[model samples]
Target: MELHEYVRLDGVGLAELIRTRQVTPPEVESVAREALKIADERLNGLTRPSFPNALDAAGDGPFAGVPFLLKDVPIAAGVPFTLGSRAIPDIAAAHDTELMTRFRRAGLVALGITTMCELGLSFATESARYGPTRNPYDPARGVGGSSGGAAALVAAGAVPLAHANDGAGSIRVPASCCGLVGLKPGRGRIPCGPDTGEAAFGLLYEFAVTRSVRDAAHLLDAVHGPAAGDKYLVAPPLRPYAEELDAPHPRLRIALTTDAWSGVPVDPEVAAATARTGRLLERLGHTVEVATPALDWEDVLAGIRGEVVAGVAPLLSAPRQPPPEALEAVSRAAMSEVRAFTALDLLRTFDAHNRVSRAVGTFFADYDLLVTPTLGQLPAPHGTLDYDNPRYSVDSWLRRLFAYGPFTAVFNISGQPAVSLPLGRSASGLPIGVQVVAGSGREDQLIRIAAALEPDFATAADRQGTLDQ
Candidate 1:
């Protein structure tokens, strides 16, 4: 098959072709290199290419011949790690992260590192250090970060799937902006070990942003489990996540909310898209009710942001801190904010964490899932949310960041499994995803609902163009 044709297949499709000897992994890697050469000129999605090892591993499991990209923020063995900031210049990992080892075991070949915001401190993808990763649907707009580059490459058909991690809205925000399936598994669903026990209030989770729900499922299947000693473990699925895709989700009571949790005005286009998603789900034999859960949205956000600052504080205090010039203004400011917190303040934040977790847990007891727009608005122009702005106060900067993406962080705080499905689009043509969130340890329900909704929702072709183009 032609390189462009080969690049168009989903990860699973490519894996089957390779297993059947219809396509070689080296060929896929070669095609991916060419696609990146063409796509990166406009998208600026890749930070570094990993062609050598990817080619070496071709013809190796189910995904032996399939090519993949890892977001620059996470450590993938031998791949350059530059959290999209000059402060942290490119440094290749000496060994694979636990997640990387799982990917290798599953036959995935890592081909490159995708871009992210500086230290992943913001939701927009314009890295002062690495330029911006533009949405493939419109070169002028943003591809939400810190997983922006991964989302961009997948959306542009540079690759079928790419690694993405979420602390706030990193994975789902970009998936919403770029038109893909992004699942942020519940805490402990996919272990981030050998380096750290957990991330920021345990709000960070690792997963991928992909072109199909099944690809996301397959990825979770391979990576889900405790690694030796973990801080905690999410309840295991009764069966493999891949199997859940075909199971019928019982008729669910889904609570639909268009209210921006941050009190920011949600763009009318986004509101319409959320409404349309609710209507579509209703048609698919599910009940969707528009109601606000009884919870203090502001407090929930404040708790998550506080934990983020405190959780990442230790990294900024490294003995060999990056030169001031190398760091983004927002990152520096956030570090400064972290320094202001007293030990007692962090303890108080933990108290807030327990409160928020319980609130979300109780809300889910009555409703199987909660549906909301993945983002508050459509994709914005590059550089509109300034990560490097010295003039902006930390509160002001965070307000703007939360305005762009308010729905995703809540699940992260509650440690519940949530996914963004590319179910709708803005009038200007950017993708708008609807978030499906389930209670703690119930990824199966989220996967089942996502699978049922996938066929009913619009495809990437409907909003963008043919992947095979």
Candidate 2:
């Protein structure tokens, strides 16, 4: 297989070719590696030392031998899990996390671990540890983080779909910036671990970003299910997610809003594109109305901060603590501030989470979906969310991340499923994502709608012209 031919095909497409014996797995892997080298050189999307013997590591399943990459955050046996920070050593995981086992069983071959933001904290992928993961569409621009490196490689056609997880829009934001399909399955729709019950207090979701919606659907089908000793589990999808692509949905009541919950005004281009997607939905027979869920922004932000602190504080306070210079400014600041947090602060944060979830859930009772701009602005220039800058305090840094992606984290807070589709583009031809969110355990709705919307966006081949530059 040729690199061009390989880059043009999505995960499902490649699997079909291999299944039909038109190409062998080894041939596909070789071409994919060539493309990956180019992507890393051009975009700096990968972390050190590509996975050794990755083809040997593949399992026999639906996507057997299809090229894939894991984000550095996920645990894969003998693969470096850096958490995208120097603060954490590049220690290879002792064993596979449940999701990693699922990826292997699905037969997706991981070529390497991709870059991410420090502690998965920011909205951009410019880490002091690994530098920035540049947007393929515009190398000068940022790839939204901490799934930014995964998005970059997928967008560059190095891999069709790669592992991505979302905590506060990490998956969707990058998908928006890089022009790909990002599905953050509702909390509990996908399992987090045998290692930990719920990650980031249930704010994080395990999934992937892909060039096509069907790839997203098929990947979800292969990996989603409950594991033993899990803290939360939603009822399984009625059918495989792939089946939902051609499934018909009733005319949905979709609420459209470009309003940012954090009080930041959305960029004009992003707002117009979101409104246009709402109009498209209206034309497709859905009722599109100007509506937004009533939310207490203060509580929502605070609850999110509590979750971040809860997840990161332990690492900061570990027996072998990372030296001061090993950590980013925001992380170091968090270390300092976490000591002052009262037990009541965490309790109040949980209380706020309950209030916010209930409020958003009520709004969903009247609507089948919500649509919004995936980000408040375009793909930012590198350093826009600089982690090394010492000026940031923990509170202000959290505020900055939410301000950039105000529409996304609320769904994370609400534990609802949401997807970002590359449905529109800016005047300059950069992709603009329009997010579609469904109520809890409603990934079926997201799949159907996203599949319906997929045809309107440019394909991977069309977007891969960035490689020529």
Clashing pairs in 1: 25-65, 50-111
The CA lDDT of each predicted structure is: 0.80, 0.87
Query: Residue 387, candidate 1: how far off, in angstroms?
Result: 1.3
TM of each candidate vs. truth: 0.95, 0.98
Predicted structure with the largest lDDT when compared to the true one: 2
- Model 2 lDDT tens row, 1-469: 8776888888999999999999998899888888888899989889975666783455469999899998887478777677888878877788888988888889998888899998888889988888988888888999998899999999998899999989889999999999999999998878899878888888888899999999989988998989998899889988888999998879999999998877898999999999989888998899999999999999888888887777677775678887877888988888778878888988998998998999999999999999999999999998887777789887888888877888888888889999999988888878899999998899999999998887788875568445533
Looking at model 2, the pairs that clash are: none
Mind sharing the TM-score for model 1? 0.95
Could you list the CA RMSD of all candidates, in the order they appear? Answer: 1.8, 1.3
Model 1, C-alpha of 429: deviation from truth (Å): 1.4
